[model samples]
Target: MKPSGTASAHSDTFARDHLPPAGQWPELVFDLPELLYPDRLNCGYELLDRTAERFGDDRPAFRSPDGGVWSYGELRDRVDRIAHVLTDDLGVVPGNRVLLRGPTTPWLAACWLAVMKAGAVAVTVLAQQRPTELATICLLARVGHALCDIRSVEDLLKAQVPGLRVTAFGGGAPDDLTQLAAARPGPYRAVDTAADDVALIAFTSGTTGRPKGCMHVHRDVLAIADTFAHHVLRPGPDDVFTGSPPLGFTFGLGGLVIFPLRAGASSLLLEQAGPKQLLPALAAHRVSVLFTAPTAYRLMLDELDGHDLSALRRCVSAGENLPAATWQSWHERTGLRIINGIGATELLHIFISAADEAIRPGTTGTPVPGWQARVVDSDGEELPDGEPGLLAVRGPVGCRYLADERQSQYVRHGWNITGDTYVREPDGYFRYVARADDMIISSGYNIAGPEVEEALLRHPDVVEAAVVGRADELRGQIVAAYVVLREGAEQSADSLCAHVKSELAPHKCPRAIEFLPSLPRTATGKLQRFLLRTSPDPHGRVALE
Candidate 1:
């Protein structure tokens, strides 16, 4: 019952009304003509319906590890039935917010399309998130409807506010989505929503220890696929996509789902997509394009045993920096160069990446086509090549936080200042240094921790590493490390520290090293440096023994 604005607002009044001030939004630059979307458009119509029409209706869409492949026609029809149920059966109105939490299944994908098709905004949450985290998201997005799988919806059920229309999908519930779709699955007209209507709200992992909701519109969804997937990935109808990212992670949403469907291609959805499971699924499904984190790739290499990865043509690594050692090792083993890139939750997906021959090992390549990026100083002035500074990016899809004061900090003077510290080469390749906050300043010297970590990773015994600044009364802060070493390898802290000294300058070496069984990482494979800063047993670090 909100007042009608430029776009229809059937019931999504909370989100639209709570959006940050217009002046606070970054100056979105849509230089590419393809970035311009029609006023009234539904992404479901574009990603599902019209795609089916273009590539014959029966063309394959999504394939799972077990369930048979779903054709574009089948997917579109399924989405329509779900949309019909949302609007007619559940009283879901246009612009209403719908929450979706479930395992990475084809049904969840269907629900995502259904919500948008009904002109409602979709809030995709990680299936494994804690109840408190889920509740915070529910309250922030003001979700009034939820469609979830019974197996993993305990938190969602607890998180949901009263008056929420909950519909279970799997687990054989009496009113599950499957049972309802089985009753009446057919054609349902998609709402003609304004391109500006918010289609989804993606949440950040709170690596900074605080979560923020990022608002993306219908056009924003397609813009990412057009820029990153279309230009860099170059997937075709014949290609089969598969990956390890969760649907809630924008990286997964873009790589696993949007990219393939946009190119008339299909993807393999794996419910338990660990490194072990991925290898078998990749060969069995003959997956051509693989999407996963650098850590997963490193783990896959360990268990390769000459596994048949010949079917893979494009292997993309994001969610964290791809170490030079990991990239080289993956190529040496699989004969495929891992495509490295840097993306952010604020920018939707990767605005900086390169594939195939464009890749330069150890660097995250150049800014993605249709986007502009540069290294900037503290004052927002562009820095010269080879000088490490903050990475500033401006594109069609940029920072749009939901009613958060951090909007001003993230989007300053029109550019989205990604917290990443990067060095731009003269040839335009961008090398990641460390996060701006992750930089360690000691005794009037500035050090990038990733630089030291990269050198440490070169050691044959080192498996994974994370570098952070530990407080030092004498030097203000010192370079400290939490390393995961290969089993039965050189476990001495001095041996590793001395090895780092051989590779980097004296100041860059880890002043203190602590060997760990595993480094802390987010579900999407991003290192959690903040956790290291607060480790309770800091006194246990090796004292250069």
Candidate 2:
């Protein structure tokens, strides 16, 4: 296997050669040979097949927070048993959608694997999601049955969506469907599924509006593993993978489940992976590779003064842009570069990422292998290097929003138009500018809010910063900043605003600054800028000229 550095070099080379000229649409280069399967197969079965053949009885495949470890052989056995139970006992079969609700645990992993292995579509809902969100997702997915943690059954019951058979795992089940691993037959055969058959339905964060389910086939899992893990992480069998992302998010799905299994590595699944829980888990597991978002890294840095993080070799930052200060601080403390990537629910996982050796702090780096990226104008015309425009991508796995006509809007003319603004350097590195929706149009000048946020993050007193566009009577919309200062840092609004104006363009600086104890974020750690857009001091009135 190539070293991480070598893989990044190959990716840089491909990006250099394939990226379109300034103002031209990007042309992708497909180098992979044709395959027997036109679409991808569900990865749960593929994982079972690999483990059963190679290290079935050897290493532990999953380690749960409760100190339970399941060997590959045991995991496969349990998955088979559950598959049989789902098919024979519950009457679930191919084309049926099964709702899975639970925390990130070994049982959740087993349930996810079993559902797909049984040829049923798995719809995973975040355990923290309220009853209304859960009910909407269940109704939208047309879920016939649900496998959820016993602790969360009350929430499901409150949703009051009738006719849905509920199966309780982790705790004793008193419901219609229960854990049948002990009683079900172990010799279960997987149903033959087409490559295009839907294996899982992941819901997008409703940052813009209501959440929509993003449909993905079995092939997307392996495709993401091959593109991101093979080309970016390059994990070995001995590598211990762990992170803070919830299992419900595709980011966690790729990092904790699919990537580790694809590379024959072991993963540490913590029931609670907040900053308070992550440090001890990483130390206890001797985790070598870490995957999390940029915000988590910032928080971890604060808690790592005397922590022994010597075991970590690579740390991946995703879900949002990685600030240069966060990257620099992490490297200075741990001597490890944080590999930043840009992924979406629509893409299923990461498409643009940087490996350790080739990491360009503050930039999202080049595209992963088998994927193509470009910065394009409003009309889909390619933008010149150093020019910010909307980002578009094409790869083996693309967005197929479930039952939504907006799929056409996201996927236009064979290119998935990811609603992100970015600038590509002449050397092929792509820097994240901001979300397309978060762009501030002030007096006809286009400004990416994230650029200003990054500038604020460089200030020593700043712990966290969020930038958003605020409505302005004169400028149409102006930049606004919400900041969380470090402990003992003064919260003088004027000084902070002055600091930002000095570092960034006067027009790009926050027209107002709001002090906060903490900024709100999604479970995946993405900054919730929409909340800031509606704030009372939307335009930073305190510092207005």
List the candidates' TM-scores in order.
0.97, 0.92
Judged by lDDT, which candidate is best? 1
Query: Which segments of model 1 are wrong by more than 4 Å?
Result: 1-6, 537-540, 543-545
For all predictions, the C-alpha RMSD in Å is: 2.3, 7.4
The residue-by-residue lDDT of candidate 2 on 107-200, one tens digit each, is 8888889987887888988887888988898887778888888887889889988789888876755433344678777867776665656778
lDDT (10s digit) by residue, model 1, range 1-545? 11124565446566677777888787787788898777777898899888888888888888888769899988888888889889878889987889898889889999998988898989998888888888888888878899998887777777657677788988676688877876665998888887778889999976777799998888889999989888888889999999999899999999888888888999898888899999988889999999899889888888988567778899999898888889999899889988898889888899898888888898999988889999999899999999988999988887778788999999877789999999999999999988888999977799988888888888888888888988889899888888888889867777887888898888787777788899887766678999998885444365532
lDDT of 1 at 459: 84
Task: State candidate 2's TM-score.
Answer: 0.92
Cα shift from native, residue 100, model 1 (Å):
0.8
